[model samples]
Target: MSEHGVDSNQIRELGRQALGDAHLQEAYRSSTLRLYTHRLAAVSEVPGFERLRERARELKREVMDHLDFYLAQFAENVERRGGIVHWAESAEEARSIVGEIARRAGASEVVKAKTMVSEEIELNPALEKAGIRPFETDLGEFILQLSGERPAHIVAPAIHMTRHDVSDLFVHNLHSQPTEVPEQLTAIARRALREKFASAGMGLSGANFAVAETGTVVVIENEGNIRFCTTAPRVHVALIGIEKLIPRLADLAVFLRLLGRSGTGQKLTVYTSLLTGPRRPGEDGPEEMHVVLIDNGRIATLADEKMREALYCIRCGACLNTCPVYRKIGGHAYGWVYSGPIGALVTPQLTGIQNARELPFASSLCGACRDVCPVKINIPDLLLHLRSEAQERAPAPTPSGAALGERTTIRLWAWAMKRPWAYSLGSRLARWGQRLLARGGWIRKIPMYPASGWTDGRDLPALARKTFRERWTEIEKQ
Candidate 1:
């Protein structure tokens, strides 16, 4: 179990459940395909999109290389701008830091913009435990909060849900008249959350990017809620992962361009807020601004050269939209906050491979994620690397007498493959053996250990009637 109490080992079972639900499958298929298509269309409009990706990759690499210097500079600049910077080495520390800050401010409630890092650290539950209520201001997040469900996608938290699902949830929780219209649902959530925003003592958010040179925290969103979350309350706190920093303010534009296009097919998100610090004497913003820089295993990822590229992820979730495995299983199956291809890489590393050994193997390794990644992260390569690390660290399986038959079968197959005569004989025999099970040019079931597993989910094409060598020989004679 991870610190979050999520077991990555249960991924297969969770994936199975996800696959069996037709509604869930349709939801994932539609949402991901739409996002994938949008991203392609958006990227095509940019003549140097690949160059942009390469540039983004280079900038992230620079940050990862000199992370310490940039972090210190960012902290100094933030402090200079009157924003307090809190360092948290782990999830518990981060939660504690934020909780303490809330307590000091005498905040009984906090209005939060959509921030994955807060979810990563399980801050909501901690806040509840600390006798504070945290309201999720994002529409999708708000729906999920009402339902007591975890996010199913990084970008679209309630991607697994439908309009009907949201309507039903709103009717049940908000006591609003059920309506499937998108605008109606938005109004229902907004009406409920507006009160929370007005009454909450503090505003909480996660930084999309924090500029080292200018001491700025950048947040982008389509809705205007983030603006309210940062401005409406007396106190505002931003939870940022250590990897969210960029070297300079000038570089923010490059990422903003990539993030919007890659995430939602927009030229730019509707509201891009640059927060430097708390409000000045007559300003209409929070009186106090705090930024919690949480490591929570990012430093460990940084130390490993092979896995460092995972940090370059801007959380745009383009990889998730393009990943086949993620499209099928969805985000929750990976059993952690960050899900999809990037989640598979980040989860095992952040939570330890022993706890999340199955995540590295949960991919088809199709390289779709690699192709769509805004920062040009070679996700397939990194997944393979994590698979190796998981295997290396995995305990050796115990010898079992129940496996004797399988071992003998493998040995015989290996022996037969080494000799032409034996190989030919084996294929001929297999053709004869499959005659009983073969139907409609495919073998639907083999009724055996290994082959049965394959046949359970797939059909095997029946072997050809004539051998290739025999056909070639006949052709030569003709």
Candidate 2:
């Protein structure tokens, strides 16, 4: 297997592992179902849901098309409001910029909100390398942090872990008594994170939208921990993607309506704070505010006219909840910061397609993602585009021995398909030859053929006596 390509064997192994774990299966299935049910109810109550989605799409398109102008304008306004803006073309640059900020602040500890971009750049490890301990404020993120695990879902990061699992983790890690109660678990996390919020020298977060009109960055969260991270710390750093821009503050209202409803079934998130810059005069907020605009492969993404719709994603994870494939194997199988439908579409692009070739093929192309996306991104179309790109960029090598023989047999079958007489003769030969392998009307195995691997798990259907074309011709004559 190519180093860039995801190993097919690894995918199968992870899938089989997930399927065998009854607890993990239940955790993913129930959580995703709940979110799906909530989203349906919330979206149904809105009168113009589709129109709202289109409006959101339009706003994003406008911002994306004029990205440079808005980005500059947004930076100028932020500077005017006593904040600093940094531009990072790559993940290394972003990390260095953030590390400098933390080091300058003499920070020993940093508090962070739930930010996918931070995950994308692997920020926590960098901060640790800089001798600054970073604490995850979001409940799900905190759980993953404690357990040393990656996020299994986009919105609900620890959706794969059950309450019992969490309880055991806490008991083992935090030295707390085992308790499966959700509220107690939340309290345990809140208590542990509260000290980090107060003692940390800086806070780091990701913005949902960066409005060019007022140079305001908007963050929406239900936990209220984000509120503390943005305000409690002396220095606050917001890492934003170049694509997360809007022309005006007024446009934010349209997205606010869709984000919460589509994500967790609320009219709006519990805490929606707009921070223009650092604290002013007597107002209580961070003393220093910095916005780092990251363009880690987003410029290339924007260049692709066919896949640009992916830039409109708002990180809602609604598509994940609605996807059947995501519900089964779960997010860990995708082997990246993101998972599910959005992951399948964007990961190969964000990471090199060569490194993530299997990501595109991970999808079933069911179109549920397109149905639930608030911005109405054509996820299926993008998946197909990436699948084709994967095949073109990284074709599978021909195997030697029995596998090579199977390849030769398939090629011969294709040749026979082009000629009518050969195809008829081939069908008759297959019927007679398959009888040798068939047992109880099924092919148990085929020695020296790659078909055995497939038949190892499930029986192959027995071949028919006559081809469909032959039967159809006879019926026509009658």
Maximum-TM-score candidate: 2
TM-score of 2: 0.93
Pairs of residues at least 3 apart in sequence or in different chains that clash in candidate 1: none
Alpha carbon lDDT of each predicted model = 0.90, 0.89
Model 2, 274-306: lDDT tens digits are 999999999999999999999999999999988
Show where candidate 2 strays beyond 4 Å: 1-9, 397-402, 405-418, 446-454
Worst 10 residues of 1 by lDDT: 395-404
Alpha-carbon error at 326 in model 2, in Å?
Answer: 1.1
TM-score per model over all chains: 0.91, 0.93
Q: Taking the tens digit of each residue's C-alpha lDDT, what string does model 1 give over 423-454?
A: 99988999999899999889998776667667
Runs of candidate 1 with Cα error greater than 4 angstroms are 1-3, 395-442, 462-478
RMSD of 2: 2.6
What RMSD does each model have against the real structure? 3.1, 2.6
Model 1 lDDT vs. the true structure? 0.90
